[model samples]
Structures are given as C-alpha cells and as structure tokens.
Target: MDLPRITARRSEGGWELEIAGLGPAYVKRLSDVSEHGRTLMQAAGVTGSEHGVQVKVDLGDELNERVRSATQATVDAHRAQLEAAAEMRRTTMSLRGHGMTGRDIAFILGISPQRVSQLLSSHQL
Candidate 1:
C-alpha cells in the first residue's frame, strides 16, 4: 500500500500542505473532516482559517476507507494531545486547591517547581 506523502509550501497568506495523488473525492472527505482530523492536518503543517485550512491535494484515482483512516489518525493524535493537556491543567489546579504546595505538586507531577508555579499563575486557580 502507498502511504500518503505530505509536502508543504510557503504561500503569501500562510503555509499550504500538499498531499500527493489524493484526488477530489478524497479531498472532499478531508474537507468535511472531524475537529480532531482538522487538528491533525494543522499539526501536519496546514494553516487554519475561519472555515478550515485550504489543502492542495493532487488529483488521482479514488481512495479507500483504509487510506482515509490512515490520514485521520493524524487528526486523532492531535486531539489526544489537546485532551491530555486539558487534563493536566485540571489535575494541577485540583492538586493546588487541595492545599498542595507548588513544590509538592511539582514533585508529584515530576515537573519543576517553577513550572508548577507558572501553571498555577496562568490558570485562575
């Protein structure tokens, strides 16, 4: 099976991503992508817009679901990163609310105390 090839170019507006041989139908499928898929595409170097990032995929034969899933995995990975970050923030705040010192929280989280202070300061808690 041919893995999807990703390339990028700088445009006057922003970065544009090109997926070689991903025809119009596949492009449409990507266009109607889930939020996670969109996040993955952004991480893959496509710039975001109010509507969505504009992807430049080359025309080719029809693509299968397997290929689409392979591409969608990129988006899912990005989504997971976002979820993890949110959870970390919540956990840090919860620990702080429990009267844990910044140093203690840092020790528990295996992060630096300074980093813990920064996280607590930036957040309302």
Candidate 2:
C-alpha cells in the first residue's frame, strides 16, 4: 500500500494538516480524532483501501515556533484589550462616585452618554 502524502502547516491557533490518498475508513478515523479532542487531521481525498493509512506529520520545529509566536501575540493583544476595558470601567466608576453625571463621565471618557448610561446601569454602579 502506498503511503499518503501528508503536509501540515501552522495556522492561527492550531495546525492545518493536509492528507492525500486516504480511504473513507481512514478519513472517518481522522474525524473521530477531532471529535475526541485529540490532534486534528483532515483527509483531502480518497483513492483506494490498498493505501492503508498513509500518515504524515509535516509541521517541523520552525513552524511550531511561528505558531507559538502567533499564539503569544494573540494572547498579548487580548490581555491588553481586557486591561483597557477594566481601566475604563474603573475610571467611569470613580468619576461617578465623585459626583459626576453620566453626561460628564461620557465627555471625560470620550464616549457617548448613552453608552456610559448602559455600562453604569448594567454594572449597577
């Protein structure tokens, strides 16, 4: 049985695997892996059962490094967004506690008064 040509590349948050020459049975097995929270592998085509399960792991160290870097960048960006949101909430609350109206808070924070009202109402602040 000839082995399938397998190639893998780093994707945004995971790996993109490509498998060629996979039979229906083998393709089902790959889908099972994904459903079970194991490594994700997708079959691109089917030729014949004589090919067995031609497997390939093409992602090397360099690709792994890039994936890791991209993941870290995404995490950092999300963290910054969360921190900014928290800061905005804190500033808004502080201003409100110091006798500021919704209009005043909105002007100080450079947001619409309606948004300020919504935030304050939702947060019960």
Candidate 3:
C-alpha cells in the first residue's frame, strides 16, 4: 500500500515537479507523462521501489487558468494597438497621396515624420 508523494510548481515555460523518494525508473515514467502534456496522477505501487514511497507531480489547474487568461488579455491589447496604428497609417497615406508633404502629414497626424514613415513602410503602401 505504498503511495507516491508529489510536489509541483509553475514555471514560465511549463510546470515542474520534484518527486521525493522516487526510483530512477519511476522518475522516467513521470517525465514521459509530462512530455506528452498530461498531468501526473497519484497512484500506489506505480514506481515499484523497494521502499514504500514515490512522488507524483502536476500543475495547479487554477493557476494555469489564470495565467492563460492573462496571456490572452495581453495579446488582445497588442492586437488593438496594432489595429489603431494601421488605421492611422491609412489616414496619413491617403492625405499624402492627396499632395500633402511629410511635415503636413506629421502635423495632421500629430506624430513625427519618422513615425509616419515607419508606419507606411510597415504597411508597404
């Protein structure tokens, strides 16, 4: 009736687990599970060590969910900023095509000519 003991932590790339008292074989099995993106489950006698002890590891689901949500928020914010910049570029380009000079475009856009040039170059128009 031996049981494995597991402790896990969240990292920037993924989850990390430190299993105490686990044999090499069992550690390999746990590592395999993690590589395949599966949570390690607590099971008895899975390690088959001479000592009646093992270690199980997995990530905290609640924390992972929060991290995912935050990441999505950041991505959305960046997308919005890019969309706004593209819109400004379109407006400035239209005004320039109508015979406006770089200074006039900058004044109308309330930005520098360098910034307008960068945006136009990025859009390739």
Q: For residues 53-106, what per-residue lDDT tens digits would candidate 1 score against the true structure?
A: 434333333544556777899889999998987777788899999999988999
Model 3 residue 73 CA deviation (Å) reads 0.7
Model 3 agreement with the true structure over 38-122: per-residue lDDT tens digits = 2333232345333333434444788778878999999999999989877998897798789998888888889998987886677
Q: Model 1: what TM-score?
A: 0.46
Better of 1 and 3 by TM-score: 3
- The candidates, ranked best first by TM-score, are 2, 3, 1
- Alpha-carbon deviation at 52 in model 3, angstroms: 29
- Give the runs in model 3 whose Cα sits over 4 Å from its true position: 1-61, 121-125
Q: Give the distance in Å from residue 5's predicted Cα in candidate 1 to where it truly belongs.
A: 20
Better of 1 and 3 by lDDT: 3
Q: Candidate 3 — which pairs collide?
A: 4-54, 5-54, 5-55
The residue pairs in collision within model 2 are none
Best by TM-score: 2
Candidate 2 Cα lDDT to native: 0.61
lDDT of each: 0.59, 0.61, 0.61
